[model samples]
Target: MNLRLRSNAIMAVAEQLVVGITFFVLYGVLIRSVGAEQVGILSLVLVLTSVGQLANIGFGSALLRAIPMHEGRGERHLSIASIETSALCSALFYGGLLLIAYYPFQYLITIQAGPQYAPTIAAMMVPATINVFAMGLGAVSTAGLSSIMRNDLRAVANIVGGILCLAIVFLATPRYGVVAGFWALAAQSIFVLLATWLFLYRQLPGLHLIPRRLNRTVMRDLVKVGYKLQLQSLLVMALEPLSRLLIGHFGTLSQVTYFSMAARYVMQMRGIVYSASQPILSAFSYLRESDPARQQQLYATFSTVIGLAAIAMLSATAAAAPFVGELWIGKREPLFEGFAILQSLGWLAVTVILGSYFNAYSLGFLRYNLGSHVVMAVANLVLGVALGWAFGPWGVVVALTISLVLAGLIMGIGNARFQPHGSRFLSLSNMATLALGCAAVGTAVAGYHFVRGYWPMLASGLASGVIWAAVMLPAFAFHSERGLILNLLRLRIKRRG
Candidate 1:
């Protein structure tokens, strides 16, 4: 089972990379043809999205938990009521809030871009906000699918959406400007909403829509689950976007420009592992420790494979960062020189990967550390803003790195207490090993910058990724540590034979 989980993690990462790169590549092309001014409204719209997702408050996680268990245990009606009731109410609430937010978008625009772009920005936020609401209609179900690892279906929808969005951006954006991007996004939302509903309805079949007689029990359950997750949502909201806001205000738009583009690639790489981790982490952490073998299952599944894959990818991306900024964005410019923020926040990627199970352990036991998540986010945001004000973009970067290290440490302690029986791996030596590896990989890649030409540097950086992965894989796969995993697989194969 651990072997399967590891394999699944790799496949999911591969799919995410292929699908995500398609979208980013198209976006890069569009940005090249028509500078950030033409389609930059998307970033502002993303600001609203970050808020809207928090507003979801873990409805997706709760929905995922409810449905499959109910299906397996034969509580179809209850499951249907839970999914639909949650989805419809979520849509109504977020949609209306977004609509109400329209008039005030001028305020948001003024904060970000000042009065000159404020009016046009306000206009764009309207459709984008509505699209956000439309997304709420389907997203809970998708989250459930992801939790169950039935994300092959969701991934298909994503791939399709990415392709459509690419065509929409290229064909419409250049001719129509930023408005085309918004309109295409709205259309894309409509496409996915229909797809999500159809998929869920087919799977559940007896699912019904009961707007008039809302199930109080289902609503209560949703709240029970969402409240625990709300802290996570809130913390993510406060911390994730602070750097951008800080950079935009204190530094030049070009600084915000370089950091934003570089950060996107970094974030996307981190996101692939995160996507795979979320679902399985929940499932594994819930296994009974009375089953000692299952404890080993958790370690083999998580520490051995997932950790190595994340480290390898992190190394590859850190090495390739300069090439992405200098050549990939289409023009050779000094935009590649200042990546301190990118490098600093890159540490968070490791924290995110190593600390993957921290939240799941808390939530699985119903410890509901919303207060902790909120506290960490607030501390990070406050420190980030203060430092950003004092020192500029680097300040925010430094603050974020400090915050994540503390956050990861805090969560590591809490998670150990939450599940002492599992084969826990958040020791000081382990962290030291990870840090040393990051330094070595980061230093080797830094040398590529001295190549003095984009084309040569890009080629070498790409090749270096292969070299690092080759070295990391054997050190991991043949570990004396997981001798049992190798033996168990052999037994299973012999038994089948």
Candidate 2:
């Protein structure tokens, strides 16, 4: 990657890390203040409200591809219209749906959460609904900024919004409880929505918050691409909520909190790669027509780096679960620790397949992506029911892990057909990396089971990480992109000096 692309990737990662850390702190506070059962109720409500994303009908995702391609072709007007039309459509549709479904959803929550927690959850959904709707508006701007290679601006908005969220959660949770947390989320979403639009307005001169006209051709083209994603969203949106719902139905609400918290931890770790890889989609889209060779190169580079990095991070997280769990929740909950470690392993498998996902989407291989989700949904349902029945909450987690592994394999195999000749997904180097990474994770998990005490667990985790780095260094020393990345770093360091 060139310096500009590298900078954008760094900025994107920075945004996620900052926002994730801030929210991590907020959740810690929430758990402490409101207790786990209330947080469980909060998590359940938020997950249900997240279905509001379906209102977008994949227009937001289409914008990520459409805006970049249009801008690259010098059709700024088309980009503007696409953004406005998508935001308007999503907000209105979601708003109407929420109004119609409010009582039914409330009844569902009442059934799921029971009478004691139902009122709080019902109230929380009000702000949570606004939060999701704001997200619909902000998703469009977020896509526009990313497509234009200005994630740095999105980073700025997110940092400020995260701080705002933290302050609200910290102060208000003490007085008002779980509803305060939803209020904070709503506040942060609106802040980000406004900030993102301001950034876009400054970046694109002809941009307007309101649309002069919605272009039929742009909307139609976006719908053509987005409709598949819309269908896919049904399965995609169901995955997490399904997990939580099953846990709640089969186990206790506290298990729901633990699972949700553990999943959040794993997701934040995965966010590092997900954020850095966001620009890969735009880059691949840009290169699809102009440079197939460069597109192949980009895919290989990201796949290697992201795959290895994801494995290493998740391995370390699994090993250090004891320390991380205690530190995160202010005490040791063996349930949460178990959930974190197993969820880390599951997400680790999914993270390794992210490059293939970007490749498929950028090249209009939507069927591959959709097919992967179908596999995920089926596996999660089948394994989740069987395993969950057999082993309780941990069984549910195992089911999730197994499902992710299966889905990832499906995606990888499907996308491999699209790779250029001689550009294989599992090169010798990648296989070696995966093998070694898996071994390290196995060692870490085994050691974690035997090792006692926080310091010993942390030391074991560090030792495993060091050994893995040492083993990988020989391979990276001769890797192709190493020289470019090193040279860029050296130049930057010298320039600073």
Candidate 3:
């Protein structure tokens, strides 16, 4: 990647990390003040709102893919018109869904979560739903900006909006409770929308914020590309809510709190991977036409980095779960339960990171096959629900883990056979390194469990880190893109100096 893109990726990851930590702190406060049940209700509310993204109808990804191609082909007017039209359509679609489902959503919440949550849920629903609409609009602007290589502006907007959202949630949630958080989210969404629009307008002088017509031609093209994308979106959107709902039904709201907390931590780690890889996906798309060899090199570098980083983070999380959990939640058992869940689901993180790398490669090359994505989505939902029913929250995670592994294997095989011939596949050496990494993680977890105390956990973590660096770093540096990795480090060091 070029310096500008690399910097943008770093900024995006840093913003997400900061925002994630801020939310984590806020969640800790909410749990401490209002208790886990209230937090559980809040989690459910957030999940429902996330599911609202399904109303986007895959326009977000469609915009991302389409805007770049249109600009590349010098069809600037078409790109701008499509963005405006998609934004308008998304807002209308989501708004209408909210209106129709308002009463049904309320009834569902009351029946599942109980009467105590009804007022808060009712109060938050409108703003949260509005937030979804704002997010849809923001997606278009963000995609346009990114496609034009202005990702830095998008990162800045997100950071600023995140800070504002954190402040709102911090001040309002304590006094006004869960409803305040939803309003804060809505505010954050509007901030991002305005920021992205401002940056986008500056970047593209000819861009139109309002379309003169509906542009049926653009809409038809987007829909043709988006139908399969929307199915994937629906599957992704439904996973979390379904898992949480099952926990509520099969276990309890309290279990939802535990599971959501663990899942949040895992998701944040996954977010790091996503933020870092996203820019590369855009680069890959450009390289596909200009430099196929460079595209392959970038893919290998990105996949290696993603895999190694995920292993390190998840291992450390597992090793230090006791100390971190006690510190964050002020209770040992529930947090430990969350850790156990993480332990069982740790490999799932690696699989997801790898899967994302493959998907991005495929999308960039315009060779993405929807069949595997569809299968994985369906399998995940079925397995998640069935496993949750059979063995509770842990089972849901296990099901997800299995589904992800299966998907990864299937995709990996397909990539090896059908993707460009020279594209790197996981070799025996890489597999061996991964196995050793897993063993190191297991050692860390075991050491922490047997030794106990903060110091022991710290020691275990340090030892695991050392082992990973010693074994995996050398393996990657020697076996993969050594020059690229060395150059990246040198650049960072030079910048620091």
Candidate 4:
């Protein structure tokens, strides 16, 4: 990567790390102070907001694609106007939906949390709704910044906003409860918008946000491309929230807390992989156009590294859940149940990481396989609901895992056919690496069980780490691209030097 891209990637990782840690700490505090039920309320509201944000009708991504193209053609003013108009429309549409859904949402919350918590739930919704609108407006500015290759600014803005949110939540949740937490989130979203606008202004002093005539042609183009994307989003975005909703309705609020916390922890771990991989998507796209052979090779390497990394990270996390829970939640036993759920769904997480690369490959080749996405979406919803109802929280995760694996296989096969010959999904070496990684994880788990004290547990964890390294380093050195790992390590050392 060039210096600019490298810098942006580093900043992006930092931003995600900061935000992840903030939320992690914030959730831990909330769980300790207000109890699991209040945390469930907050988690439910946040999920609802995320699902509702899709009402933007996919214009957020549309603008990201459109802005760059227009800027390349020197139609910057028109692009700005077009994005602004789309954002305005999205905000209005989302706000209208929020208004319409308010009473019904309140009714559901009342049923779930009882009439005593109803007022708190209602108060939380006010800022939550405003946060959704703030996000809509901020999307336009962030898209513009990304198009101009100032994507690092977006990361910086997020870091600032996240810290502010953390502070607000920390200060307010003690006295005011969940309502104050939602208000903190609202402030964070608003800050993100302001920070993004400031960065955009700095980058393009001549750019204006004033309302302009709606460019019908641009609107039509965005809608044409966006509506198809929105269909997939509508289906996919509903899965997680709906799963939690089911848990909330069928199980107790405490179950919702367990389910959400486990899912959130796993998702945050996945985010680390995502942060590393996302920057490469554009690189992959560029290589597809300029160097198809190189693109195929890099895709193979990236998929292997990402898949193995996810397995290692998640397995390690699962093994250390006891320690983490001890520190974060004041009890290790309470976390075991959630950790079990994560363990049951471990392979699914790896596949989800790999599937992201596959999806990027499809996009890089300009092949949007709508059918594949549609199938994945449908399977997720149907299986998630059915299995969740039948088996409970773990069942929902099982359903998601099965759906993702099936969808990933379909997409992988499709992508392989498009690549040159000899491009395999799981090369022999890759499979061996995965096997050894799993073995290492099993060793760690066994050690945790057989060992007696904290000192022994620490030693076992260390031994497991050493064993994984011993196996993986040699495997990568001899089986795959020779010296690739060593070269990366040396380069990192040199950079530090």
Candidate RMSDs in Å, in order, are 4.2, 3.8, 4.1, 4.5
**Which lDDT tens digits does candidate 4 get at residues 130-152?**
88888877876776666555668
- Which candidate's TM-score is highest? 2
Per-residue alpha-carbon lDDT of candidate 3 for residues 23-55, written as tens digits (9 for 90 to 100): 787678788878888888888878757767777
TM-score per candidate, in order?
A: 0.85, 0.91, 0.87, 0.84
Give per-residue CA lDDT, model 1, range 169-222, as digits (tens): 778766767666666666667776776566666666666433333588888887
- Ranking of all predicted structures according to TM-score, beginning with the best and ending with the worst: 2, 3, 1, 4
Model 2 agreement with the true structure over 1-497: per-residue lDDT tens digits: 12246778789989989887987887789988878888888888877566877777788888878876775566778878888777777777878888887778878887898998777977887898789888888888888888878899999999999999998988888889879989998999999999998898888777775645566777788889988877787776777788888899889989999888888787877788788778878877766645567677667666666776676677666656666676788776799888888878777777887777877788788777788788888999988888889888888889888877877788878877776542343667667766666676566555545554445645655655555556556655665545543543333110010
Order of quality (lDDT): 2, 3, 4, 1
Indicate the worst ten consecutive residues by lDDT in candidate 3. Answer: 488-497
Clashes of 4: 0
Candidate 1 deviant stretches above 4 angstroms: 1-11, 37-41, 209-213, 285-296, 331-363, 366-372, 420-423, 427-433, 452-457, 466-497
Per-residue error for 153 in candidate 1, Å, reads 0.8
Query: Following a full C-alpha superposition, what root-mean-square deviation does model 1 have from the true structure?
Result: 4.2
What lDDT would candidate 1 get against the real structure?
A: 0.59
Q: In candidate 2, how many Å is residue 130 off?
A: 1.0
**Candidate 1: 10-residue stretch with minimal lDDT:** 488-497
Top candidate by lDDT:
2
